[model samples]
Target: MGLFYSLRGFFRSPGAPPRDAGIQSGQPGGYSSESAAEVTFDSAMQISPVWAAVKLISETIGSMPFNIYEVGPEGRKIATAHPLHRVLTRKPNQYQTDVEFWESMALNLAISGNAYAIIQRLGNEIVGLLPVSSSQVETTLLNDGTVVHAYTTGANVKVYGPQSMWHVKLFGNGIVGLSPLSYARNSIGIAIAADNRVSRVYSNGAKPSGVLTIDKTLTEAQRAQVRASFAGLEAGNDDRLFVLEAGMQYQQISMTPQDIQLLDSRRFQIEDIGRFFGVPSILLNQTFGQSSLGSNVYEILAAFYKLNLRPYLEKFEASVPRWLMEADEAGRYECEFDFDAALLRADLQTRMQANREAINSGQLTPNEARIDEGRPALPGGDKLLIQGAMIPIENAGLKPVQEVPSGTQESEPR
Candidate 1:
C-alpha cells in the first residue's frame, strides 16, 4: 500500500527511505534484495543539533498567528511560514514575507520589556539580531523626586513614570498618538516605522526637548501667604492687595464689605494702607477730631450702641469731675479738662458690648468709619471749604470744581 503524509508530518522526523520495487527479491516477507539492504538505519537517520534546534524553534513559532521568516546573511530567505497557511488555500504575498514586519514587532516587544531585540533581513542584507537586555532603558528624574524608565528600539519607544498611562507615539511621518501605557502607572509607549526618518523623544507622551524650569524664589513664608490668600485669608497688605496708593487720585475701585474686611486685615500696616493712605496716626487723629462732627467718645459709643450717640454723652458726663474748668476763647479746654478721657471711659463699656455681640454673632469687623477726604462740603448743595475758604461746588448750573481765576469773582445773586 502507498503511504501519504502532509508536508508538516513529513518534516517531523528523519525516517526510513522507501524501498524500490526493482530491488525486491523473493523472500518470506517480501524483503528488498539489494547489496545495500544490510545498511544500518542509525547512520542514515542521524540529525544535526542545529537542524533540531531550528525545527523546534520553527514549530514553536509556527503556533503563533504572526508571519514568520528565517532571515540569513545577504538577505537570503531561508524559510517562511504563516499561522494561517494551514487554513487558507492561498499564500500571502511577498510584502507579508519581508523582514519589516518582524523588525517592527521586535521593536514593539523590546519597548514593552518583552524580547529585547529582533533579527531579520531585507532582501539580502542581514539585519543584526537584537539582544534582549534592559541596559538600554533610559531614566529621568522629575522635579518632585520621581525616577522614570524609558525603553526604545529603533522603531518604537516607551516610558514608565510615576503616573498611570503616560506615553507617546509616533509614525513614519511624525507624531501620531500619545497616551498612558497602563492605568496603574504613568507609563507611556510610542511606535514608529523602521524606515521613518524623524526622531523624537517623549516623556509622559509629551515631547521634552526644551529646558524645563520652575520658579523657586519665594520664601516659605511668602509661599504660605500666597496659599492662604486662595483660601480667603488675608496674606497681609503687600502689593498683593491694591496696586496703587489708597489716597492717590486715580480710577475709583468699588469694594464689597467683605473685601474691605480682608483688605484691612491683611494689609501690611507700614507698606499698604498706612503708607499709601499717607495719614500718620497723629495727623489722622487731629483730622478726625477737628473735621468730624462727633466726638471721639461718640465714635466709640456708636459702635457698641449700634449707631446711637446718646450713650457717648452719658459716658462723658460721668467721667468728668464736678469742678469749674476754664475754657479758651474758642470753647476748647486749655487746662486739659479731658483728652481721650471721655473716650477711655466709654471704651470699656463699649468694648464689653462689642465683644459680647461679636462673640454671639461670630463676627469681628474693625471700625473703619472715620476716613479723611481732605475737604468738607456744606449742606446748601453748592459750596466746598478749601483751606477755610468757601468755593462754589458748581459754576452756574454746572458748578465746576476747578479753581476760578484769582481776579474773577462770583456773580451776585440776581
Candidate 2:
C-alpha cells in the first residue's frame, strides 16, 4: 500500500495550471507581462559593471585559502591534510587550475543561485571535483521526493543522483535555486542597452558624415561618384582631401547635446548594475564619497566582507561538510575558508600593535602571533602573556601604598 501511494505521488500532475516561465530559461518563477527579456550570464557580461562586479566577487572568494579541518570535542580545529584539500588548492581537474575552478563555480553561484560540481571517486574515496556548467544542468523531481540532476552535454544527457554531485544553492526551494539574473533581468537589460549606446558613440564609426550640398544638379553617375568619394574619406582615409570643382558645401554635423549626455548616463548605469549585484559604488571606482564609513579603508573592507562576502562563505561552510565529507565523519569533520589572513592584512605597524594587544590581553601566545606574522618562534614564546598592570578587578587597589624615599622631593606647584 505504501509503495502504491509513493508511486502515485511521484507521477502526479500539478494541481493547478503552470504559470508563465521566468525570464531565465529553466527557472520556476511565474513570468508576468511586465517581465523583461532574458539575460543569460553571457549576455549580462556585456555590461562592464556586471562583468567587473562578478569578477571582483568570484576572484576574491576564489583566492581565499580553503581548507578541510577536523573539529575536536573541545572546539579545537585541526587542519586536515586530505586529498580534497589537494584537489581544491592545486587543481580540481586537468583542464582547470585551482583558481579557475573556484572562480567558475562562484560565478555560477552568484548568477544562477546554484553551483554544481561532479564528484569523482576512486573506489569509496573521493578524488576530484569536476565543474558542470549550470546552464546545461537541470533538476528533476521524482515521485518518491528524490531529486535527480540531468546534465546535458551536446547530444549526451547524463543523470546524477544527489549523492554524486556537489550542489551549492542559495535562495532556493528544496529542488532548485532561484537565479539572481532572473530577478534582475530588467536592470541588466537596461545596463546592456546603455552599454550598447555608449559603444555606438565611442566605436563603430557612429559619426555623421555631414551634409554634402551641391549647388548644381548632377547626373546619377556623378551622384554615385560623390557618394563613393565621401564613403572613402569617412573610412579612415585620413590623408584624403575632397576636391570639389562644382559648387559644394561640406557642413559638419556634430553630435547633439543629448548624444554627449550619454557618457554621464553610462556612468550612472554602471552604478545601477553594481547595485543589483550588491557591490558598493566605491569598489567600482566611482566617485562615491567614503564619509558614511569615515574614510577608513580597513572599515570599508570589513563592511565588504560582512555585507558582500560573509553570506557566501556561510553557505559554503554549511554545504561542504555535508556534501564532501564521509557520512560517518560528518559530525566531527568540516570545511572552512581561512579568512584570518585577509581580515588581518594590514600595515606592519598596525599588525604589530594588534598582535601586542592580543598577547597582552592573554588571548594569544607570543609564538602564535609570531606564526601568524610568518616569523620564527623564540624560546619561551609559547606562554601566554598578560600585562603586569592588568590585575583582576577583585585585586585592584588591594596593595599597600609605599612611602616616598627621603632623598626624593615632590615638585612644588609652578
Candidate 3:
C-alpha cells in the first residue's frame, strides 16, 4: 500500500516557526567542527578545492541527457511521446529549464546528501517539479518503520509521504542519507583555517625579515632611528629598501622546511577534497605521479565515468520508477542517461576511436557508427563486420584445409 504522512494538526493552524533538526549553514557554532573556523555548506564552498570538486561532479552528472525507453519484444525504444519526455528533456518545472533543474538537484545531493522535488500534478498526471532545499526539509522515522518528511521554511510548512517527495539520498541508512558537508566539517574546517592563515600572513607581511646587528651599542635615540629604518620592510614595502648604515650587518632569515610544508599542505588539501567528493585529483588540476601522468589522462577520464559516475547514474535510475512512474508502467519503462552521446565522447578523435573499436569488435554496425557521428548511412553498411582472423582458441591451428574452387587456376608446381 502507498504510504502517506498526514499533517494531522497543521491544516489550519496559524503560522509558526518549524522545528530545527539538521545543523544550520552560514553560522559559526551551527556546524559541529573540531577546528577553529566554522565549517558550513557556504563556508566550505569558499574553499577553492571544495568548490571545484562539487562543480565538477554535479555539472557532469546533471547535464547528461536522459531518455525514457519502453522495453518490449523487439527492443528498447525511446518513449518520446510520453509525458515524461518533455519534463525530463525540455522542462522540469514552469520556471526552470531541464538543465537547471537537474543541476540544482545534483548540487543539493552533493552537499546535503539528499535532493527533494515536489511533484506538481495536473489532476492525476504529473506536469512539473518544484525543487525544495534539503536544508529546509527533515525526515522523521516512526516506530512502525514508516518514513515521514516535513518541509519547513519560515511560516510555510508541508508534510508529505515518499509518494509526493522525490528523494535521492547519498550513502546512509534507508531513512536519512549522510550529509557530506556535515561529516566533512572537521577536514573542511581545518582546510579553511589553513587557507585563511596563509592569506592573512601574505597580506600583512610575507617578506622575510632580516636581523640588522650593530657592532657597537647605540643610544636610545639612535636605536629609535634604526628601528624606524627597518619599519618599511613589511609586506607592502616592495619598492622601499632599508639602509644598513652605522656598521649594521644584515642576516637573511630563509624559510624553514616547516614553513615550506605549510604550502604543500594547501596543495594536498585539494586532493583531499577531491577524494571525499569522488573526483580525481587530475580533474581538480592536481598534478601527481604516474596516475596523473599526461599520457594516462584518457584512462583516468574513462575511469572517472566508470568508477565515480556510474554509481551516481544508477542511483538516479533506481529512483525514477518509484517516484516518476506508476507501478504497472514502471515495469515496462526504463530510463538511461546518455553517457556517450555527447559529454564523455569529448572530442572527434575520441569519438571516432570509440566507434572504430565498437565496429571492429562487432558490437555496432557500420551504419550505426555513422549515425553516431551524425553522418548519412552508406549502402550495405547495416551488415556487421568483425576481424575474420579471430577464432575459438580450441580451433586454433586445426582449421580444415579448403578445397580449391572449381575452374580456379592452380599455380604451376614451383
Candidate 4:
C-alpha cells in the first residue's frame, strides 16, 4: 500500500483480493463458493480451461495492431508522429514493454471486467501509464456526476479523478464493469469441487478396491485395526500382502457407471465455463465431438474473433479517446485495434485475395496495397486503376472503341 506513496494518485496493486481467491492466492481471507469450494481468481486459473481462455483473449488482443489515428478533412491516417503514439507503442512506462503492459490490462479486463492505469503527467503533458489491477480500485459516482476511483490497500486509500486515470470497462451499469468471475463463481466452484473430489479420493484411499470379510463377527478393536492396516496398504503398500484372520474371504468391488459419470461431468464443466467467457470449446482444444458451429476449425476460430472478440475491440477503441487523450485532442485523434489484423493475420492467401479485390475496385492504389503488404511501391503503382471490362449497363454489347464501319476502315490494307 505504501509502495505507491511516491507517485501522485498512483498505485501498483491495491486492495485485498476477493475472499476465496485470496486464500488460494496466499492472501489473507477467503469465502466459500456455491459448490462449497473456494472460487477465487487464483484458484480458477489452476483450472486448465480458465487459464487457457483468459490467456487466449488477453494475449491475442494485447498483441493485435492497436494504433492511433488522426482525423482530418481528407480521412483518418495513422498518427505516428503523436507523442502518445510512442508511449503506447514502444513503452507505456519504465518497467514494461507495450505488449506486456496491455496484456496485463487485458487480463484484468477478462477476469474483473475492468482494466485501469494511472495517467502520469508532467504539467499539462502526459508522460506514462502505470497499470494496476481491478482489485485495487473502487469506483463511485459523485453527487455532482463525476466518476471517482479510490484505490485501497489495508487502511491506506488513494483517490483518482477522471483526468488522472484511464479506465476500460466491460458491460455493466455504466458505473463499473460487471466482473465475470463474480458471476461465474458458481460454475467455477463446481469445477474446483470436481477436481478436489478426485484429489480427496486418492489422498483418503478409503474407496475400497476389495473387502475382506470373515464368517465370524469381528470386535470393534479388530475392525479398527483392519481399517488402519488397509489404509496404510492403500496409500503406498500396493505390493503388501493382507493376511486375513478367522477364515476371511476377499471380495472385489466391480466398476460402476457412477465413476464414468464423474469424469464426464468434469469435461462438461469445462465447456460450461467456456460458454460464459464466450470462448468456444475448440479454442480450448477440447473438441470432444463435432463443434456445433461447424467441423472446420478455422471457420470456428474466425467466428471466435467476430463474435467473442469484436465487442471488446470496439469497446477499447471507443474508450481510448476518452480515457487516454486530452479533451482538446478528442476530435483530432482516436485509437483502434486493427480488426483486419486480428482476423486476417495468418490467412495470407485470404489477405492477398482481399487486397487484390480492393485494388481492382479502385479502393486502394497499387502502391498503397504494396506498402500495406510491406513491399516497395512501383513507379506507376501510385495510380488507382479499375477493370476496363466494366462498361455502362446500356452499352453492354457496343464496341468499346467504335470500330470503323466495314468501308470506313481508313484504306484498310494501305
Predicted candidate 4 versus true structure: per-residue lDDT over 263-291, tens digit per residue: 89888988989987889988898868878
Strongest candidate by TM-score: 4
> In the order shown, what is each candidate's alpha-carbon RMSD?
47.7, 8.9, 9.9, 8.6
Instruction: Please identify model 1 stretches exceeding 4 Å from their true place.
Output: 1-63, 68-124, 131-414
Arrange candidates by TM-score, highest first: which order?
A: 4, 2, 3, 1
What is the C-alpha local distance difference test score of each model? 0.28, 0.73, 0.75, 0.75
Q: Which stretches of candidate 2 lie over 4 Å from their true place?
A: 1-40, 79-98, 202-206, 209-219, 229-260, 288-294, 326-328, 389-414
Best-to-worst order by lDDT is 4, 3, 2, 1
Could you tell me the TM-score of candidate 4? 0.79
* Tens digits of lDDT, candidate 3, 1-414: 001112422343533222233321221122332565887778999998889888987888778988899999999999988888788788889889888888888888888878889887788787888888998887876656566678998998888877778888876655566677866777787789888877765765666566778999899998898777675564453556567776878775756326668778787888777777888878887766445534565677788888887877887888887678899999989988888764556577877898888877778888998987889999978876665654433355675888999999889999
At residue 340, candidate 1 shows an lDDT of 32
lDDT tens digits by residue: candidate 2, 36-121: 33477788887778888888889987888787777787774655466777787787887898888888888888888888999988
Instruction: Tell me the deviation in Å of residue 364 in model 1.
Output: 94
The local distance difference test score of model 1 is 0.28
* Model 2 lDDT at residue 185: 76
